[model samples]
Target chain A: MAILLDGKKTASELNETTRKRILKLKQCGIVPGLAVVIVGEDQASQRYVRNKHKLALKLGMNSVIKEVPASITEAQLLALITELNQDTTIQAILVQDPLPKHINEQRIMQSISSTKDVDGFTAVNVGQLYLNLTGNYPVACTPKGIMTLLEKYDIFLRGKKAVVIGRSAIVGKPMAALLVNAGASVSILHRYTTEIAEYTRDADLIISATGVLRLLGAEAVKPGAVIVDVGQNLDETGHLVGDVDFNAVKDKVAAITPVPGGVGPMTIATLMQQTVDLTEWGLANGK
Target chain B: MAILLDGKKTASELNETTRKRILKLKQCGIVPGLAVVIVGEDQASQRYVRNKHKLALKLGMNSVIKEVPASITEAQLLALITELNQDTTIQAILVQDPLPKHINEQRIMQSISSTKDVDGFTAVNVGQLYLNLTGNYPVACTPKGIMTLLEKYDIFLRGKKAVVIGRSAIVGKPMAALLVNAGASVSILHRYTTEIAEYTRDADLIISATGVLRLLGAEAVKPGAVIVDVGQNLDETGHLVGDVDFNAVKDKVAAITPVPGGVGPMTIATLMQQTVDLTEWGLANGK
Candidate 1:
């Protein structure tokens, strides 16, 4: 059976590190601050935001949640983002995903200054990350979290064959970049790939983020392979599941991340880390 | 036999388009300007600089050639780059490759502002290119040139399997990103790649930039595949050659690029086009 990648434990350790860093910065008269803007009451978004708020405060960082109703106009949202962008006290600004249908998410994202783009979703940061340039500000949180977990587990990426299932802008794309940085020969298999089995079966490491339950079976994984499941899919009973067929592939893999406790905690962990990093950066650079 | 991808004729046609654009911009009181800095008088570097100078003039852009001694210190070279970076009249900057061993290439490259980073060697540009984020900046010229050639031939890259047999920062890495942007599944093979022939033989498009002569034979390529050879290795007899055994693979491939007449010309063509593009962009946004 595969060794389960304990993201819950890893995330707790990361929080410990972040907590120390936050305390150190405060002694220097620096207060790490994160501004989160949520439009509309997405129950999931609210819960995620509250969790972040609680975690940020626990870590000794100031957390401010800006709640705008669903009736808010795109212009008003832009104004809020701009206000945060120019606010020196707020080191990082995160606009929650799935804005109202009338609000343009990309437009709102573009409005945030790159320096304060803690989410790392701005074009400048994304572009920098893609080019392997030096100013690769914070990368998108989930992919960064995935990389952090891989490092914590001592997973060897150099010269390994990595197959990333899915080509989403957030997870798969940045994941490939991080893998490539670690000297892995990476291949991205999207909906257009026909020979995914051929690629996945030979991979030393496989990252699945298709958000589809049981998208990969035991036959698609090699024995003793490292598998990272970033999928968050709903099963028939409305329970959350991952992309890998866990039970079928468990014995074949050397290590794997379980759905509920694996990558999930790391996502929030990365966000918190980035928020702390941004706050420190802002204090130093006066962003 | 593989049909040769004619980079020479294709590049001339592209220059014409660029020249027309430059002329239109000039009519509106805008002239595309390029500042090229050449360190040392290496034959290859000299030849490349000459070609760029000639092409810039042909495209109606102001071209400035700054030749520095090979023994110049890194600080001296950086001083020259800083001037060009801040010069409003200079829209694009190309620093000839193979700088002195004592100079750190990455530091020198970072000195070039992204706006004037026509070579696209900066980490930020590479990151953006990898992410497929189209910023208001010039892409790495060589890969841009190759993409233009592929499009000119009406080769649809969507859903195609591409094999890039090199992983150099300049050519192979950016080339793979370009192929991915066009919707192709790219497998990048390097020296460490085991069983590279298996992947190369199955690819719909094969691009070799390893500079090892005759690396790809007829048996190594799929019949009717499009082969692009970016290698420019010289034989012991001083003859320029590519990575593929042209004679052996010529009969099987649908299209291929000849060694000297292929990617070489396109590189300069793209450089010239970028020079003009930078000038136009500066005119419109230089304020």
Candidate 2:
């Protein structure tokens, strides 16, 4: 049986460290703050926002949630973002996904200040991340969290063959960038991939974020490969599952992350950690 | 024998198209303009800038060359970029690479407006290209030129296995992005990559930009794979050579790009094309 990469426990440990950092910042007369703006009444978005707010407050940071109507115009939303951009108190800004049908998501994302773009969706941040630019820039949360997990587990990535099974802007893309920066030979496979097994069979590490349940199985993965499943899918019984057929692959793989308790918690933890990091960075830069 | 992907002929065709577009823009009282900035006395850089200026003028466009001293500070260079950014007549900006050791290249790159970043080295432009954002944004010249070459040869990329050697921001990185955006399963190899042949042996399309002489030979590549050589290296005999051993692999591959007349001419052609594109986009947006 494979050792489970316990994301929940790791997240808890990270949250404790974040709490200490927040306290230190407070001692230095800096209060870390995050502003989360959500347009429309997406239940999932609301739940996510609420959870983030709770975590921020728990860590003794300032958290503000801005709720706008579903009928909000793109111009108005952009104006709001501009307002938050100039607000010195807010170190990080996050706009929840799935805005109304009429609004251009990319435009809204681009409007956010790169300095305060904690979600790391802005073109400037994404580009810096892709190019491995050295400096203070927030990485996309999930990938950052995944990297932390890998580091905590002492998984050395240098010279390793890593296969990332998605090409999403949020998870797979940044995950590949992070892996490549860490000196790993990375291959990105997506829906257009004709034979994913050709790449995965030789991979030392596999990260799947395709949102397709049970997409990776025991037969497809090499023995002793380390798996990190970033997928969140609903099974026929409405139970959350990962891309890996965990039970079938557990005995064959060296390590793996579970669905609900794995990448999910680490993402939240990284968000909280980055929020504090932004505040410290802003303070140091005299912003 | 494999068919040679004649980049010289294709680049000429593209230049002809660009020249016609410039005429149409001239009819509309809008002259496409480009500002080339070179900060040092590098001989190769001088040659490249001269080539670009010649092409822009040949296509009947306004071209301005700014030659600054090698000792110019980062701030002064940035101010020059700012001046060019505000110059209404200059629709595109190009900064010759390998700036002085004292100046930070990325900072100067970021100072240029995204709208005028014809080189597409700015983080905003690079990010947009990585994410495959829609609308009008100039792509990195060499990669964009390579794509045009592929299209001219009617080489479809969807579902193809493409391997990009080297990870330089100018060529290899953007090449991977362009391939991934075109629905190719892309793998990026760098200095840390162990056993590069393990990936190259299965690639349907191989793009080598490592600047290493004869890096990709017949022994490393599979039979009938398409090759695109982006390397420019001086051989022991003082002749420019590509990373591929053309004499060794030409008979085995279905198609390949020659070094001198291949990616080189296409790059200059694409720069001219993008200059016209920027002018047209600016006119449409009333900039």
Best by DockQ: 2
TM-score of chain A of 2: 0.97
Expressed as tens digits, the lDDT of each residue in A249-280 for candidate 1 is 99999999998889989988988898887777
Over B103-142, each residue of candidate 1 has an lDDT whose tens digit, in order, gives 9887898789877889887765665666566556677777
Estimate the TM-score for candidate 1: 0.94
Q: Candidate 2: which stretches are off by over 4 Å?
A: A28-30, A39-43, A68-76, A79-83, A86-89
What is the C-alpha lDDT profile of model 2 across B1-287, one tens digit per residue? Answer: 88889999999999999999999989988899999999879999999999988888989999999999999998899899999999999999999999999999888988999999998888888899887899889889999999999999999999999999988888988998999889999998999898988999999999999888988789889998999999999999999999999999999999999879999999999999999888988888988
**Best model number under lDDT:** 2
Where does model 1 exceed 4 Å of error?
A133-136, A283-287
TM-score of predicted model 2? 0.94
Q: What range of 10 consecutive residues in model 2 chain B has the weakest lDDT sum?
A: B123-132
- Clash count for each candidate, listed in order shown: 16, 0
